[model samples]
Target: MKILFMLRDPFYEAYPTFIEAARELGEVETLYPDRGIEKAEIIKEIANTDILVVAKVKIDKEVIDAGARLKYIIKYGAGYDNIDIDYAYEKGIAVTNSPGQNAESVADNVFGLMLATSRNITKKDHEMKSNHWELSVGHEIYMKKIGIIGFGAIGKAVAKRAMGFSMEAIAYGHYLDPLAAKELNVRFVTLEELLTTSDYIIISTSLTEKNKGLINQNTIRLMKRSAYIINVSRGGLINEVDLMEALNQKQIKGAGLDVFSAEPPQNALPLLDNVVATPHIGGATYEALVRMADVTMTNIKRYLAGEELLYRVYPQEVRK
Candidate 1:
């Protein structure tokens, strides 16, 4: 089998074991298209590939058509919105993603942003470094209410951590599993209720066409003026313009964003004192990378062995 691994990160260098394992299965060709490689070049590279592994690269219809021998497309992380799974399915290409592989790391980041934003950790640190002994009062998360927008693996993980802070966890999602919520002691609530009541509102859902700009001006208005917004999921989930306006007007207390509407955002949200932003690194921890690599390799091995694949996402009717 010939495998094409395309992503900006140097995965093989960071995890030599993964490349070694992949080599055992087939001939592996890794591509580092950091500055956006041309589509024609990508088409040329994928011409003979049997298995394709991707991170954030778009696997649209054109690229799918170029892969004459492609059998499976494995997303290195949880989100597969970048890939055109519908077209791939029509062409008999199976697509899968490593869901929950980085849930623990992302959950940790959610709290990191939460504590930093709520307690003014970064601001105070900056002041102290500049020889100013500023005493800015900050809010405590203890006994506070946290509203989770998506009750999936990452959302459940965040709820589990909320328990340590003695915070009330409530969730709003399309697919809220009652048993799972009960196990985590998370209450189910409507979106408006979650927004109005939560001290910290977190966006942890996947990005779909139906909910692309889920958090907009109208939704922001529903939130408490003192409430903070935290997002560790996809950037497209929130409308950046609306969020910036709300922050500027003090509609919300602050925002802790790991993802933005545009990566390396063109806007000034990152420069705002009220916004604590990171360059979408919620799932970039070493531990998360190891787990993601394992899941990717497992699925590849399963496909090669003609066995049942885990975390199959495409061909929705046959998803398992």
Candidate 2:
């Protein structure tokens, strides 16, 4: 059995263990490409692969069909939208993710973006270094309305930090559990209500068909003009063009985004002063990488051992 490890980077902590374990199962070849490989190249690369381990590279229907020897596909993180999960499952290929492995790391980054945008921290720092020392007025997180969209592990993590700052936090999730909400000390509110009321909105939801382009023109209009929007989730959640227009028009105060529709932004968002964008490094901490490495390789081992899988998210219908 051969395993082709298609990695976006080669920095996972348990890298040697991953290779050794795969060798114990069968032959293993790990490929780390700085640029995303094309579909034809991927098919050629994984021609003999029995298991495919990857990061955020796209594995569409063509790739899944071309994966003739693929028995399992393991993702490095929680989100698997980049994979054609349903079709792959239909082809009898197993898929798994390391859910919540990097939740706290992402939550920390979310709070960082929140504070940066709310207080103009990045702008002020730039101005100071450029020899302008004028102070920038910013709002406090204390006693303020903080809306958390997508109240999963990452969202709850942010809520915990918000509590430290004495912020009144509310949350909205498709999978809302009354007990969980109560435990987190967050009230459940409708998306509309959250939009209208929150002073700082942190988006931590996974991307789905229902919520794609969620924070669009109408939703932006619903938010307070002074409100700040922060997203640490997938870039598709917000309409980038709409967001830019809103920022340019001062529709809302500003936005702090760690993810964008096109990473490296195929556009001019970074050039905008009000928008603070990072290279999607919200969950790139070393600790998170280690946890993710452990979880992912463990799942690969599980597949070989015929044990029950961990953090399985695909084929929900079949699981039911």
Candidate 3:
């Protein structure tokens, strides 16, 4: 069997176990596409691949068809929206992700974004660089109404951190864990209530068809003018154009985005002000990368040995 790695940067080192196991599985090839390549490029390079290891790359039907021998696909992180899971399933290809690998790092990064947005950290730093001594008064996150949209491991971590800051936390999800929510003191509320009542909205939901544009203009219109929204989840959860319009029209106080609809947009949008845009670095910490790689390799080895995987992504349990 052969394994192909379609990765973003060439700097990631494969886990030691994966390197050792690859010797028994023939050669391991890697494909690096241009940042702006079309679907044809992806399809072309996936030819003859068996197992495809991907990271933030789109694996549409055409690309799937190109990999005639593909038996499995492993995403580096938790989100597998980049892959066409339906097609992969129909073709008998198992799709997996390294969940819990980036949970702690993403939880910490979420708060970092929240604090930076609320305290105007980026803006103050820029002003001070220009020799301005005047202090810009920013809102304090303490005692603020924080609405978390999802209640997964990452969401629980974020809620706990918010409690430490004395923020009142609430959440909305398809299936609520009452015991977990009660333990964390997160109020279970309707999505509408979460939208209108929160002073700071932190989106921690996974991406699915139902949640693709959950944060559209209608939802944005419901938020308080003093509210700020943070998204460490998948980019499609919020409509980018609507978010930009809201920020530009002053409909919302501010936003902290770690993901975007089209990553590395053609040009900077006007929402740059009163908004902190990160290049999807929620799980980019060195510690997270190492841990995620180890988890990914473990899953691969288990699958090869015909054993059960620890961090598997079951098709039925997928967010979509």
Candidate 4:
């Protein structure tokens, strides 16, 4: 058996334990692709591989076809949109992801971004470092309304955290579980209501075809001028150009973005004084990395032993 790990730079160093365990099962090879992996190179490396472990690399039909021995594709973290799920399914390649493994890490990041943006934490720190003492009025999240865009594991975790701050939590998602919301003390609301009413709007949903660029000019217009947007999920969910314009016009207070429409965005949104941006590190904590690695390894072992796989991603789920 052969296993290929297509882990990108930085991430390649995050899973030493997983790599050590995989070696006990098969011949393992790990590649640290620069920003994006070359398709031809991936095809060549994956040709004889029985399983492929991917993070941030796009696994499309051409590469899938080249993986003659491929039987499984494992996503290192929660988001599997980077992989071509439909194509992999068509090729009889079972795809699985480590959901909830990074929920706490990402949920913590949600507040980290929220507090930093709301309180001008980063801005004040920069100013202080420059030998200038200035005080800026910052918004308080206490007793404020927070609208979560997705009601998934990460979203639920965020809602749980909101309770500690005495904030009201409301969520909007394609799939809503009333019981879950009731337990978390979150109310389900329409996208418009979430935008208009929330003091802090959080995008914690998956990026899908139906909702791509969901946060555009029209949606931004529905939000309160005092409101702020914080996205810890995929960048494609928000239209960068529209967000930049809204931020520039002060139509909205500001934004906290960990993910961009493009990784290392070519735009000036991150450069804006009101915006606080990070390089997609919502799930980069040591604990989360270890949890994700453990899940990935368990699924691989389950697949090898003919046991039921965990977190198996279905085509219909992604299509919706």
Separate clash counts for every candidate: 0, 0, 0, 0
Worst 10 residues of 4 by lDDT: 8-17
Considering every candidate listed, which one attains the maximal lDDT? 4
lDDT of 2 by residue, 184-213 (tens): 689999999999999999999999887899
Name every residue pair that clashes in candidate 4: none
Off by over 4 Å in 1: 315-320
The residue ranges of model 2 lying beyond 4 angstroms of the native Cα positions read: 10-25
- Colliding pairs, model 2: none
What would the per-residue lDDT of candidate 4 be over residues 1-320, giving only the tens digit for each residue? 99999876666576576788889988999887766567788888999999999988888888889999999999999999998888888778899999999999999999999999999999999999999999899989999999999999999999999999999999999889899899999999888999999999999999989999999999999999999999999999999999999999999999999999888798999999999999999999889988988888888889889999998887975656
lDDT of 4: 0.91
TM-score of each: 0.95, 0.94, 0.91, 0.96
Question: What is the descending TM-score order?
Answer: 4, 1, 2, 3
Better of 2 and 3 by TM-score: 2
CA lDDT, every prediction?
0.90, 0.85, 0.82, 0.91
Encode model 1's per-residue lDDT on 223-277: one tens digit a residue.
9999999999988998999999999999999999999877778899888999898
Could you tell me how far off, in angstroms, the CA of residue 172 lies in candidate 2 after the best superposition? 0.9
Candidate number with the higher lDDT (1 or 2):
1
Q: What's the TM for model 3?
A: 0.91
Higher-lDDT candidate of 1 and 3: 1
Look at candidate 3 and give me any clashing residue pairs.
none
- Positional deviation of residue 224's Cα in model 1 after best superposition, in angstroms: 0.5
Higher-scoring candidate on TM-score, 1 or 2? 1
